[model samples]
Each structure stands twice: as structure tokens, then as C-alpha cells.
Target: MIKTTRIPKLYVYQKVIIVFAALIIPVYFVNLLMNMKGQSFIKQEFSDSIQSKAQFYSNQLDDQISFIRNQQLQVVNDSDLQKLNFLSGTLDVFEEIQLVNRVKERLSTIQNSSDYLLNTGVYMKSFGRTISTQSGINKLPNQEYEIIGKLYSNSNKSSIYYQGGRLFFIEAANNSSVIVYLELSVKKLEKTLDQLVGNYGYSGAFITNEDFSYYISSKHDDSIVRKIQDNVSVEQSNKNDDSHILKFGDQSYRITYNHISTLGLSLYSYMNQNELTGSLKTFNIWLLVMSLVSVVIIIVFSFSVKLMIHNPLKELIAAFRTLETDNLDILIRPKNDIEFGYLYRSFDKMIDKLRQSIRQNYEQKMALQHSELKQLQSQIKPHFLYNGFFNIYMMCKAKDYETVATLAQKLGSYYQFVTRSGADEVPFDMEYRHAMDYVEIQRIRFSNRIHVVAGEIPDACKHLMVPRLILQPIIENTFEHAFENERKGGNIHITVTYEKKSLYICVEDDGNKLTDERLQALQKKLANCSIVLEKTGIINVCRRIQLEYGKPSGVFVSRSEHGGLKAEVIIHFNYGGGSDV
Candidate 1:
């Protein structure tokens, strides 16, 4: 053996270098391959997007051409153009031109500027008479003679033909009297096509006739023209193949063809492959750099994995162990390393889960309490119904026919108020009416022994929303508790007033003073801590207000200034002067 020491440092260096090279090399090549694949995918996707856009534009253009043609046919059938042609005695060309100008102006107003069409004109076969304001007298074609002859032979059907290198003839209703043509300029159409191509990063466009004899190119490329013309034998053949990618003179391109039958032309949009792959190339360069960086990070982290990951995990485990013995207030601290930060966050999430569990438990308990409270409320309604029906039965049994009839009617009305259909909210005036009805019935029972006083309730509060039967129970409680056994005259006063986000209803009775124990018991019931169902009318009122309007409402019982029991109900009023209770 050649001088072997305790630990071999060269082995460690060799392993590190080997690991570094192994990580970086694959990262570079894999990044390059991925870049190429991504670029190819992007190019194909971009070409497809462009092809779809061209096809949509082509269809729209075709519809516009057909619409213009139909409109021209209607103009040709117009009796005015025929009348102008049939008129004798030295034709007034000036007035006729003026009328044509007016018609052209009106048509121009309706046609979109991007549509590439001009005015509809009438051409007469006899004497080569033409009425066109779009084409001036100087711009009139000398070939108008042959064009009119062709018009008379074709009759009143629509046809399309190219003329004068700049204009497209959209001829409709070619008859003996007139040939109506909607002139669309090729320059405008070319501009529109160019705009469409530019929007989709396309380089050029080519338009060809049905027979492929004539063609116009946006880029003036003769090779593209020859290639497309040779490939498409007929107009129908153009529709068979919509898209293709071709290589032309060291450049790759994607061409999408749309056959427009309405205009008798085929549109081909040629896009450069470079434009589609441009963004992909940028993304590949970024990905290559990122991948290389990731590989370096992975290798560095692999060797340092124990120091970076294991130490923090141990610390987190120790902190978690402490949680078993300690309260929920245990604090966890992680190391400065990024890998350790992740573990720290995980620990924090665990603690958060524990806290959330405790909160959920509390919420469940509260929900159970709420459910029990609702069941109690449901029971109260049936109890009231039973008592009301029993009272009616007793009156009927006593054979007091008049009192039974009146009481039955009042009871029916009271039940109707209690069990009214619709929303939970009722008008404040309705609640007041119900309270007054209950007091009237109590007045009959108590005779002149009880005196009731109600203050002026505002008309504006008539439509203001409040809970049904909210005030009635409080007033009924006053009569039952204060005036029930009082021999002397008892007075009950009801006053309602609005005071800054709350509605205050004061029900005071001048009767026997309540002992401190009774007052405390009443307060407990109002606060919802007491479970006395018989005394729950006040509790029901409090609970309903709390449920409907939340914590801002309840009943308050104290000694009255008039030397008796005084009950005050505070209900929260919402923003629109309506009691949520």
C-alpha cells in the first residue's frame, strides 16, 4: 500500500466533484431538450391560434359581402332607379347624379369603415349609362360597355368579379334595366387582412379568385402566390385543407386558408414560424438557467442535508415533546436555515390545528345550547296555543254567549297576529295594534281596576319593521303581575321613543312593590341564566331579541318612580329606522 493515512481527504474531494459534475451536466442537457420541446409545442399552438382567427375573420367578411350584395339587389329593384332610366326628353344627369349621391351617402353612413365596401351603384346596359357617386365621372371604367353587356346576360342574380386592380365588383340583380354593384376596394380589404395578420403575428396574406387565375398578396410574394395557386385547383379545394406548415427559402411558415364563397375569393394567412417560437426561446433560456441553479442547489443541499434538515427536525421534535407536559403556551423556535424554516412552519400549523380544535369544540357546545334554546322556543308557541284554546273552551262551557263570541273573535284575531304568514318582520304599528288588542281584553277582565295609558305613536313608525308580538307580551305581563291582585286602582303606562340606534319601550305599573329577591329573580330570567319556563314570557322576549338583533337587546326590571315594578325593553334599531327584533 502506498502511504495510507487515517482518513482519505482525496476521496471526499473526488466524491464532491463527481457529485457536482453529475448534477450540473444532466441539468444542462435536460434543460436544452426541454427547451426544444417547449419551443416546438409553442410554435404549433401559435399556428393553430392564428389559423382559427383567420377562419373567423374570413367568415365575418363573407357575411358582410353577402349582406351588401342583398342590399344592392334591393336597390336595383327600386322603382326610382327604373324611373330614371325610363324617363325621356333629354335626361337631367345633374339631378340624377344628385339623387345617386344622396343614396351613396346614406349607404356610406350604414357601412362600417372596416368593412372595405363603398356605395351601391346602378349600371344600365343601353348606351352604357352608369349612376355611381363613389366612382367619379373621370374614374368611370371604359370597360363599362362590356360590363353592362355581361350584366344584361347574367340577369338579377349576384356575382363577384375583380376589376381595375383596385376594385372588386359585387354585382347583384343584373337585368335589362340595371346592374347594381357594391364596389369594395382591394386596397381597403388588403389593409384589413394585413391588420388581421399583424394581430396574430402573421407575415402575409394572399387572396385568389375561384379559378386561381388571378391573385393578390399582402407581401407581394410571387413564390407564395404560385405555390397556393398551384395547390388549390378550385374554390372548393381550398376548404378541404385549412392549415399547413411549409418551409420556403430557409424560413418556415404556417399558412391558413379560408374560402369565402360570398366574395368569390380564398384568403390565405401566412405566418412566420420564428414569431411563434420567439417567446418559447426566451422561456427555454430562463428554464435552462433555473434548472442549472436547481441542480447546484440540490447537490449542495444533499451534502448539507443532515446539518440543514436533521438538526431542525430534532429541535421541532424536542419542542413537540415539551408540548405534552406544558400548556398550550409553549413557544417553538427554528434555526435560521431555510429547510428548518419549513419544519418550523409545519410545527406552527400543528399548534394552529390544536387551537382550532379547541375553538371548534367551543363552537359545538354553543351550537348545542342554541339548538336547545330554539326547541324551548318552539315548545312555548304550543303552550300559548293550548292556554288560549283552553280559555275559549271555558267561556263556551259557562254559556256566556255574548262574552264567548267576543272572546272567541278576539282570541282568533290574536292567534292570527301570532301565526301570521310572511317574513319574520312586522310593522311597528301592527305590533302596537296587537298590544292594544291584548290590553283591551285585559281591560274587560280587570274592569275599571286597571287603567292603561298609551303615548302618541308616530305614523312614520307604521311601516318600520319590528318582531311580531314583541310588545304584547310585556304589556300582558304588566296586567298579570301588577294589577292581578291589586284592589286599589292600578295604572300601566306604555311609552315608546327612539334614542340613537336603539328603540326604548317603557312599561311602568303603579302596584305593589316587588321584593329584592323577586327583582333579582326577574333580572336572572331576563339575562337568560334562569331556566324557569313558567316565567319565560320575559325570557322569550329577551331571547328572540338577542337572536334577531344580537346582544344589544333584553328586558330590565327595576323599581319604578311611581313606587312599583318598572320594566324597560331596549331593542336595537338598524340603519333604516327598523327594529331588527
Candidate 2:
């Protein structure tokens, strides 16, 4: 009896669920992580875009400030200012007036060319006289006079100042104790800021100095600016600013600041977090919907598997279960699904084939038993047993005790080998000894009329298991058929050798009983396997070899160098065993 180990098993529906979860869970997590990464990327891109635009606006403001400075330079280098030189007493009243008119007209031209300029004027510090494009020859108050002079003395060549919502560039006139000023408006600055903040709903303020006093701003709620004022630390305001995100109240803001160093002003933009991540939120929603839809699809697929595969396979398994009771009379019902229908049909057909094979095996067993009985009956004839005893008795009467004992021992071994019903295969040495015994008995019977020669059988080959009586039948054929006419000088030679992963057993006889046609017919019969079982004697041995080691290791017949028949039995070392029955 054999014992088999049991293995853990998963049902079809369980496997389906496991496989679906295995595939879906990873995809869900991967999609979630990808969405998170995408949101981060979007935020970074928005940050970079806003910073770049803010820098652009800062550069534009710098250029405008540079334009005002250049205008001041033009005024200081004016030839009319050099010719007038308010302190010079060389000019008459009319000439001095004309000089001042020339300077005002030039200043008018310089102010009119720039879109952002509000006013341009020249103020004389030595005489307390002011000439302007906006106001005509106004004398400053004693207090204003001291302030303006101080402002002029302290100004390092040129400087910008913001007073009462007005931006100005002031410079000293060349070669004269005079001050020149140009005031700028906010129209162009507002338009540029609108362009930058239009796409996203971002609002900001422009601060001229570090103080949160007076500033220019777009139309935004006052609370937002107040929130920024309350939250922006002194360190954050004064430092070389980098873009950042901030949380104020219940809302989040992306805060960025760009500073124009020349004007001592900074532009601060505040973007709502919701607006910046709106698209990414939409993407996350879409991904979530797809995940839900995937789960629904998996559920539907699992249900389909239960209907189409699991149920049908269950029926097939139940049908196979009947086989445990040695029942082959199972009728598997057909399925509506085409694949399962075909499977059910094939399974039914296989069962039918198994039943037919079982019946045929029973009949073959009966036939084999009948054939074995007939063979035993033929082998154990009264004449063979009586002749063997009589020969022994004569040997004993002639006082040949040793020869008699040897003959009796050979006879016992031959009968013992022939009568074996348990094993189909025996070791090569045992078969070799049995064949030698048969040959010895033949030699005793034929006397000097026949001879037997067996070549050296290597020790390595003596242990190989070959079919019992595989060799004896060939030697028996030589006496029965080969030397049927004459026995004198009859020769039998045997050789065994191994080569090319196969063992070859050769038996040759010197008796020339077969003609060319008969030898050819015998060779053809040995090679043809369809009629192998119909053959007797040597052909039967050839068939047994074919059955044992397959066709490549079957017997071959040829004309021997001894001028007679040679039968070679080929057996492979790798041939598997066969049933004795």
C-alpha cells in the first residue's frame, strides 16, 4: 500500500477573489500616490510661474524708475540751465526770464514723452525760486525752504521719494545749486499688475518701504491685507524674500514677494490655495470615481466567474468524485457555456475510454492465463521428464557419477528457471548460467557432432536485468532449425558486449540451413513489429525484446562470419520495467 500527502486547496471563487484583490489593491495605491505626486508638481509649477511673473513686474518697475532718473540727468545737463545759472549777475531781467522759459519748455517736453510721469519741475536752492511745468514761479515758505535745502544737501546725486501718494525722482542740476524733480503716476503699474494676476484670482499690494503705512493696491478686501499685515513678520518683510505658502484663519494662501531694490519697494502677491489646486482636486475626484468603478467591475467579474466557471467546475469535480468508488458509469450534464460544454463532453469521452480499457484488460488477462497454461502443459511433457531420468540412470550405471551429477544439476537449474512464474526479468549472470546449462546438455547429447563457444561476459554487464529465457530460445533455434539436416562440425558462438549506451547479445550458428530468400524473410519478420507476436522461436524472443526496450533495442538477424545465421539481441540500459503478466 502507498500513502499520498494532502495539499491545501483553494476553491474557484476564493481564487477569483484573491486574484482580483491582488491586481486591484496595488493599482489603487499606485494611483493614489501618483495623484499626490501630481498635486505636488502642480503646486511647484504654480509657485514657479507666479514667482517668474512677479520678477517680471519688478523688472518693469525698475525700468520705469530708471527712465525717471535718466530724465533728471537730461534736465541737469541742459544748456539752458548752464546759461541761466541763477546766481550769475551777467544776465538782464528779460534774458534771465527767457532762460528760465527755455528750461521750463524743455522740462515740459521731457515730462510729456513718458506715459507714467505726472509732473516735472526745477527748484532753485540758492534763491528760493521754483520753476515748474505744473506751477509757475512759486516761492517756497521759510519752513519748506529749509526742508527742501536739507533734502537737496542729503540727497546722494539723485533719490526717489513717495509723499502723499505721489512717487518722485529728485536730482541736482549740473553746475548750479538747483534741484530737479519728476513725479510718476500709477496707471501703467496697475495695468501690468492686472495682467499678471488676471488668470489666477491673486491680489497684492505694493509697499514703497518696509513700513506697512501707505501703499498702492488693487481692489481687494481690506481684511486680506490686514491678515497679511498681522501675519508677515519683520524678518519675512525685510529679508531677500523667497516664495512660500501660509495659513491664515481657515484659508491657505501662497505668498510670494518680489523686491525692486532701486526704489526700495516690494510687491507681495497672495493666491488662494483652493484656486491653485482646483485642477488637481478635479483629478483626484476623477481617480476616486475610477477606483469605485473598478471595484464594481471586479464585483461583477467575480459574480460572472461564479456563474460561468466555478459552478461548472464544481459539477465536473462532483462527477470525478464517483471515481473513488470505482464507478465509471458517470453521465456529466452539458453546460450552456460553450467552453464548459466542450470540457464536459471531453470528460465524458475519457470516462468511456477508461471503461473500455478496463474490460479489454480483463479479457486479455483471461487469454494470458489460457496461453500460460498451454505453455506449461507443453514444457512439462512425460517424455522430457522420463528421458532426463533415464539419461541420468544410464550415467549412474556406467559409473560416470561426476558427469551424472553435473547433468542432474544442470537439469534442475534449467527446470527451476523455466518454471518461475513470479518475475519476468532476471540478472544477466543467471540467464547466462541457464543458457550455459542448456548448451552443456546439448553438447552432451550431440557429442563431437556439435560445439558451443561463449565469449567472455564482462562483470559489469552480468548484473543487468533482461527478460528471462531471452537468450535460450535463440540457441535452441540453432539445433531445431539451423542444423536440422546435419550436426557434424556444427558450431554455435555467443558474445556479449556493451556499446553506445546499449548491451548487445550475439548468437551465431555455423549450420547453413537457410537459403537467401528464407534468411531475408526471417530478417523481415524480426524487423516488422505489427506481426511480431505471430512469430515463434527467435522471432518471439525478438518481440519480447521489442516490448522490453522498445524498437531501437530489438533483435537484428544477419549472415554470420561463421557462414550461418547470427541473431543479436539489443537491450538498452535505460529501458524501464514491464508487467510480467
Models 1 onward score TM values of 0.42, 0.54
Candidate 1 lDDT over 1-581, as tens digits, reads: 69866884444334555676787779678877877887777777787788888988898888877777666666666665555555622468787676556555544543544356754455654424565555533223556435644543554444765544644454434354456666676777777777777754447887877666666655646776676566665424546678886777787778788888877777887877877676666786687678778777866766575465455666777787888875677666655647668668767776776787587764664464355444433543565556556666776788766876776677677767765555566778888887877776666565447888997776555666876656877887777677777777688888888656577888998877577788888887777633446535666676666655556676788888877788888877652223433
- For model 2, what is the error of residue 471's alpha carbon versus the real structure, in angstroms, after optimal superposition? 34
Pairs that clash in candidate 1: 155-174, 467-581
Model 1's alpha-carbon lDDT is 0.66
- List clashing residue pairs in candidate 2: none
The alpha-carbon lDDT assigned to residue 425 of candidate 2 equals 70
Candidate 2 residue lDDT tens string, 1-581: 89999987989887988888899999888988898898998898988988888888788778877776777887887878766764446678898888888988888888887777877777765545777776666767543334445555664454866555656777775454767877677656666666777666545545435566756665444677777677668536556656776777777887777778767776777788888887777887899798999889888988888988898889888888887688887888684659989889878887886787577764664455345333532454466567678888988899989888888998898788877666667788888989898888766655547778887698777777777777887888787687656846688899999765578889998877767898898888887954655645676676666655667777788899888898888887554333222
Error of 1 at 387 (Å): 54
- Count of steric clashes across candidates, in order: 2, 0
Give the alpha-carbon lDDT of every model: 0.66, 0.74
